[model samples]
Target chain A: MLRINDLHASTQGKNILKGINLEIKPGEVHAIMGPNGSGKSTLSQVLAGNDAYEVQSGTVTYKDQDLLELAADERALEGIFLAFQYPVEIPGFSNEKFLRTAVNAQRRHRGEAALDAFDFSAMAKDKMALMELDPDLMSRSLNVGFSGGEKKRNECFQMAMLEPSLAILDETDSGLDIDALRIVSQGVNALRREDRSVLLITHYQRLLDYIVPDYVHVLANGRIVRSGGKELAVELEKTGYGWLEDEAKSGEVAR
Target chain B: MKTATPDKSLTYRDVFASGQAEEKSWARYAAKRESALAAVLDRGLETRGLEEWVHGKAAGLVAGDALPVRGEVAAAGSPEMARVAGSHLLVFVNGVFDPARSEIGTLPAGASVQPLSAGDEAADLGSVARDVESSFTALNSLFWRDGLQLILADGVVLEQPVELWFVNDLAGEAGLIPVRNLIQVGAGSEATIIERFVLGQAAVVEQPLTEVVCAAGSVVNHIKLVGGEAAGEHFGSTHVVQRADSTYRSWEIVTGGHLARRELHLDLTESGAKCDLNALYMGAGKQRFDLRTRVNHDAAECETRELYKGILDGEARGVFDGLILVARDSQQTSAHQTNRNLLLSDDAVANSIPRLEIYADDVKCSHGSTTGQLEDEALFYLRTRGFSPEEARTYLAWAFASEVIESIPVLELRAELSAVVTRTLDVVDDTLMGELS
Candidate 1:
């Protein structure tokens, strides 16, 4: 469903992603685990077409089309959704209004009829239930005065509503408590399908317990240094990223 | 009749000979009119030298040929009329009250609506608005031929709002239309009044003055909407006096004119009185808007709140000068004032001056002013949600102005004004003009 070949990216004259090569097939769930400032979030932003990060050299193909050529909103309309690490707080813009606008935008792009307010409300109610979000939260300004967990749940709620083909969960478990983590994980798991793909980015292995991934890749120094199964995450939690960093350096020296 | 010259000072001789030739017919308020004209002759127009008029060139603009009175009636069913339907309307064409066009027969008992020419029974003519130093108030009082007088008796409440529509159809003539309105709400009364001004496609100078007297325990809401396609000038003054335990709220929306200037003065005369003054001004092209307001807390335990916002685009200029005064012996007074402005273009200008004068040591007062452009982070967030850049800009601008728009007590009126704000912003920002469609 997605392919990345030696993705090289930078922001503000500083290189971040040195060489990222990854691939995910249909219905596959891939996880990227790394320490702080390891380009985990950068990879997600670059895929979502953030102008701040320039792709110095690389190619990203989504469903057979070049992804780097599209604008941020165009990418969103093309079924690419990024659950932000820090959800933005927009004052005076209602969550329901934002959701409907986004839903209708993608619908129009797909040559489908727009949903009226009544239909949109019904659909939003169902999705809110899936995320365990209160109905009152939808009427309030988008993310304004929302708790951290509520914001994360709102991102999950939006993913459920849009039903994107490819979803990038950028640190979706960073600020969540145990209960909120479970709810958010359940929300993501419910949306899994044969034709869809998921890219999970996280620093902790706790989220992996709820939404288990098919493969776990350890990223360090802007490169994927290790690829393993789910046991690799448990092993890293027991040990630490320090041994991995030393091993990567020793391997480079041997090379 | 002598034609007034633009360079010469606007004196009483020029106003009387040029605009007030028929003043002798208004015999009931003759002495008041004479004094008001004398005051204008002594002070002339509000000059740039005055502190209150420094940011606005009101005297220079009105110094030109004294506005000749035009009485042409606007066509029925004009688009402007349709914009303000579903209200009890009192129509005034070119400063003259037209009973035939007014729908005031359905007023509830204990309420009275009449033309100021009816008699002196309802005339507090220049009582509350006795600011002799103000040239605009003097101008209106000197030549205002006829206006509306609304009075609500004690303990009475109006279920429907009264809309005073002032339509200016000058037949393409450059003239003056001075309007005077007197509204008195008796004790324990409640009412909402709207004053709307629509100008035809002419260069008319509109000088309007409204005096509101709120009796003890009364509540009054006054809304002023001034705008239209006409390339004209407007100078309006509203004076409000609140008795003990009374409440007064005023919402002023200024959207259209070559030059628009407004002054609002509110006085909390007795204990437990309260007042709220909110305004929004939208300026585009070379249009200019100036607003000056003062709230005086005269008695103990009075409260006042003031908020004014402006959106300026193109080369438009906006000015806001507001003051809150807490006099001695008026302890426990609480006053808050804020002025916020958004400039869409580099050339657009906004000047905000907020002042507080407190003589009572035991009072709480705060004032602040902010001027800025749209935030980059907020813009990016909207774009990521699938909205085009234009839509994002429009939404943010609308949201910035909605803080004041949402405060309107009337639901339908609030919606109408919200739409107007959107359309005005659309014109200023070309990128968002047709994005909604």
Candidate 2:
């Protein structure tokens, strides 16, 4: 459902993602792992159509449409969801309101009627239950004063609410504890379907133990140096990215 | 014959001469009026060295000699008027108490709300908002014919808010109008007072003055909702005094007036008194919104918190000057003042000044002010959530105002003020894409 051909992108005139190529068919869960400054997050941001990153030379085809040509909001309406690393703390906007608007926007994009408040609240209640989030948290400001675990859960709750066709989670497991990791993984695993795709971007192999991916791709210096099964994450977890760095610098596994 | 653009100070002198009724029975305070009139005419139409007139220019208003004491106009209100409460509207038309439009019902067991001209309490009218303090109050005292007087007997709790609607309209005439209000909440009494400025008038200058005195242990909530298509200048002031253990919470939501400047003063004279003063203002087009707060902590163990936020777009300007003074003997006093502004346009100007004076050896006082534009990260966050760029900007602006309006405990009033803030944002047909509708 997604194909990237030599995705070269940069931000603020500094090149980040360079000479990257990847493909993910429907229902495939792909994990992108890399060291610091390896362009893992940049790859996800570029895929989500973030304007901060300029696509110098790349063609990202999503379900046969030019993904890079769409605006950020248009990409979102087209069922592309990017769970940010740091969700903004909007002071006065409640979570319920924001999520409801998003859900309605998605429905409108699908040529469906908007849900009334009652129906929306009912849907939100079920999602909150599944995410193990407090019902009252929806009434509070979006991510304002929320704990790290709650924030991740809220992002998952939002993902569940929107049911995006392609979900790219950028470092969703960074600040979560073991319990929160399992819960967030469960929330993600529940959304896995034959028609939906997931891209898990992380820095560690611990998250892979919970939500096992169909394939693992290690990005090094903006290019995928290795791609294998889920066992590659466990192997990298034990050996670390040290061996890959040598191969990356030596131009050996640069494919 | 109307000097709509008089150029000199002596022009208002002629206005004062023809406006006052020196021999009337309610004119017992003619001596005070005479002195105030002198102060106004001497300071008249001159803003050269006035310390408080930083971005506020009243010389044009004074030079116009526009203080003709609101004459009778037809009581037809515009469709923009959104009354927050279903309670009685003590309508003050053209700055005078309009008995015809005011629909006051039976009060609590021992409460009374009437015109300032109807009772013997006129003797103590200027006790809180003294006429000698400022030229604006002096001018209001000089021209205010009738005002509101709300008195709650000791221990009486009036749940229904008393809404004083200052409904003023001058059609196309530039006129400086004044209205006054005196509220006395007795000891242990609780009340809520909402002052609504329903606008849809042009060339209207409103100078509303309010004085509130909360007795010992009393609780009072004051909400000032200023909005709706108003033009010209508006200079309003509210002075409050709190007794021991009394609590005063005020929320000023200013969304109208071409040049609106409001000053709120808090005198915590008794120990253990607590006061919360919050304000939210929005300006679009060429509108200028100025809000000032002065808090004097005169007693020990008193607390004060002042917060004001402003949103400016187009070439609008926002000014916030807050001053907190802790008396020498008022030890253990805690006070904090904060002012924040969001400028939507590059040409929009925001001036924030915070002053703190601590004479006491042991006191906690802090002040902070910040002026900034919308954060690109925040905008991007919303846009990524499926809102268009314009919708995201408008939604963020509207959310900035939500913090102030959500504090109103009265549901209907909160909803009404929220709608007014949306109106001030100039939402598309005021529907906000049916989100807030």
Q: Is the docking of candidate 1 incorrect, acceptable, medium or high quality?
A: acceptable
Candidate 2 chain A, run of 10 with poorest lDDT: A246-255
Interface RMSD, per-candidate values to 1 decimal: 2.3, 0.9
| Candidate 1: Cα lDDT at B330 | 97
Residue-level lDDT tens digits of model 1 in B165-259: 88776545456778888999999999899888886667778888899999999999999998886287888889999999999998999997788
Please write out the lDDT profile of model 1 over residues A1-255, one tens digit for every residue. Answer: 899998999999999898888998989899999889889999999998888889999899998999999888888888888999998886556787778888887888899988888999999998899899999998888899999999999999999999989999999999789999999999999999989999999999999999999989998878888888889899989988987777666654110
Residues B272-332 of candidate 2 have per-residue lDDT tens digits of 9999988998888898888988899999999998889999889998899888999899999
Q: What is the TM-score of chain A in candidate 1?
A: 0.97
- How good is model 1 by TM-score? 0.88
Q: Which residue pairs in candidate 2 collide?
A: none
